[model samples]
Target chain A: MLQFSFWDILSNLLIATQWTIVLSLIAFVCGGVVGLILLFMRVSGVTPLEWFTKGYIEFFQGTPLLMQLFLFFFGIALFGVEVSPWMAATLALTFWTSAFLTEIWRGCVDSIPKGQWEASSSLALTYIEQMRYVILPQASRIAVAPTVGFSVQVVKGTALASIIGFVELTKAGTMLNNATFRPFLVYSLVALIYFCLCYPLSWGAKKLEGRLNVAR
Target chain B: MTYKLQFAELLPYWDVLLQGLIFTIILTLVSTAAGIAVGTAGASLRTFGPKWAGAIVTTYVELIRNTPFIVQLFFIFFGLPAAGVMLSETTAAFLAMTINLGAYSTEIIRAGIQAVPKGHVDAGVSLAMTKWEVLRHIILNQAFRKIYPALSSQIIIVMLGSAVVSQISAQDLTYAANFVASRNFRNFEVYLLAALAYLLLAMLTRSLLRGLGRVIFKAK
Candidate 1:
């Protein structure tokens, strides 16, 4: 077996970090968009939409993300269309993230007082208008901390993409560990890198949560 | 353009699948209990331990929280043996999972413990209850009641996260699926069947936890 140098491992990890970030950004953005739609559908006046959204949330939330990733990777192919690992990972993460994000944002939106909806409606605003002008703005404030917090989950989740052959930090660590035959040191470094990436956001989320609690 | 779906091909493997399911359940149960124990200790350290201890706990929680479980598993299974702490693949997988679940559960349970009202503790003290007594009879009980939902949810997450162990070849449900798929070259069908099995298992576990919670927390 060829021995990998420290510099080689570091450089490879750095390269893999880009994929992690890219995967995270894609998942977050796509999840945000889908989550918004699910949120509205969840609370929308239409009954079928509400039920459908609830089922969607439960189905994704109930199952393991690994299974979801596998389903997307292989499930789609079973129907005769081929998808790359990146595409499969993105789709799975986006769907998984959206389910949880919808729930989080729904809680935020629900925490807004019932009176605001009535007050906006009294001002001759339509339902969409009221949401646009009043409810969403207030809800968005409450949403910020949790949203940022959930992004940390998204970041951590990108690691699962590695299972399906999407090479990210975790996958890179495996490669390095295989070559160096040094599991503990490599994984400790991997954990440290992840801590560096996640701790700041966790701190920020806590700070924001504290401020929000005070404001309330 | 027309490949017929074959359910019959998978029927003979039902016995293997059933065994795989049982193993998955056993793994989940063992890890969940072990995780709760580790988590409770970690949570107590954060809540009631000294400064340095709290800092250590904080560092551990953050480290486990940030990194991926797959990496952690690889380190334990593949990494530790290199350092002379050799363990079987299954043992290593379980140990890694216990630690990972412990860190996350520590945070959840800590939040639950902190959510207990100050008045309750004061009341316990006024009744001449010792610190340990207050913690056990009053504070801890109430905290568990409050955090049961979060704890249950975290347990499910742990169960799901357990799937990562397959990478270390633990012969769990996912590993079985991987093996069956390779043997039959029916990757999609095998995984699809495995996904259904996972979904059923998740639902079953959730209901079981819910029932247990109801039985334990009669007031709830």
Candidate 2:
């Protein structure tokens, strides 16, 4: 059996952490785009689109992300297209994150008071212009802290990708544990790394929230 | 390239799926009960206890909140034996779920506790109510009433996240899905049905909790 040093395990885990970061970034960015579209559909004043968006958010929110991943991984492959774990994880996480983001953004948009909507409309502004110039700008301000807070969830959510065999931080930790037979050390380090990745975001969200409250 | 969706193939495995669903519900019930207890105790201690006790709880809450649920489950299930703490798969799953919810609800409950107006506490004090009396009758009731919706949502979220327990080979619904999928070679159908089962379970749990909330706080 090959002898593995401490540095070997640490360095390998560090290397894999980059993929976690990359996946989280991609999911966050893509999810944000999808969420924006869903938000528009949800608030568009068109009943069918609004109903569709509501159902989309509810389905994604209600199901576990693991099942969503499994569905994409196997469902897509069943259609004669091979689906990698990476692709499946990305698709699932993106859709899951969008559901949450749209819901959060909707709450922010809804908080702008009906009077703001009425005032914007009474200015003879079109719906698009009202949203562009009046509603979204104000909602975005309140949306900042919660949005950052949710990114922590997105980062944590990527840990599930490891179960599907995406060799991210958690997967790398498990593989290393098999090699080194040090489950305690490997998993604790894996968790610590996640904590480091997530805590700053959580802290920043708190600070922004505090500042926002003070400003109000 | 041509694949027909055959959910009918899963009918033979209905009993196995039902067993798994029951186990998932049991896990949710146990964790939700214990987790809320842990949260209430932790919140009370953090808000009213000595400085060091509050700091200790704050650290625990932060550690658990920032880590992933699967990693925490892996740590308790796989890693703890190395440190001389052996836990069965079910026990570890339960512990992980409870601890995860405990951390989240401590924050939520703490917020609720803090939101209790100071004037109410002052009035309770002036009324000659003991500290415990005040906490029980005056403070906690209002806090629970205010934070009931958030606490219910957290419980549901933990229930959904419990699907990860199957990764540790716990006999949850997801594990049953994986078991049948591997045997039947119907991975997509198995998982889709399992997802639908979960969605139904979530809806059921939500309504159940909503009813419970109405009963508990009905006087208010």
Best by TM-score: 2
Backbone clash tally (model 1): 0
State the C-alpha lDDT per candidate.
0.86, 0.95
Winning candidate number (lDDT): 2
The deviation in Å at residue A31 for candidate 2 is 0.2
Q: Per-residue CA lDDT of candidate 2, range A104-132, in tens?
A: 99999999999999998999998889889
Model 1, span B1-220: residue lDDT tens? 4667676777777777777777778888898889989988898888999989999999888888877787788878877877889988889877988899899999988998999999999999999999999988887798888888888888888888887888889978888888887777777677778777877777887899899999999964
**Clashing pairs in model 2?**
none
Worst 10 residues of 2 chain A by lDDT: A1-10
Q: Which CAPRI level is candidate 2?
A: high
Error of 2 at B196 (Å): 0.7
Score residue A137 of candidate 2 by CA lDDT.
99
lDDT score at residue B130, model 2, on the 0-100 scale: 100
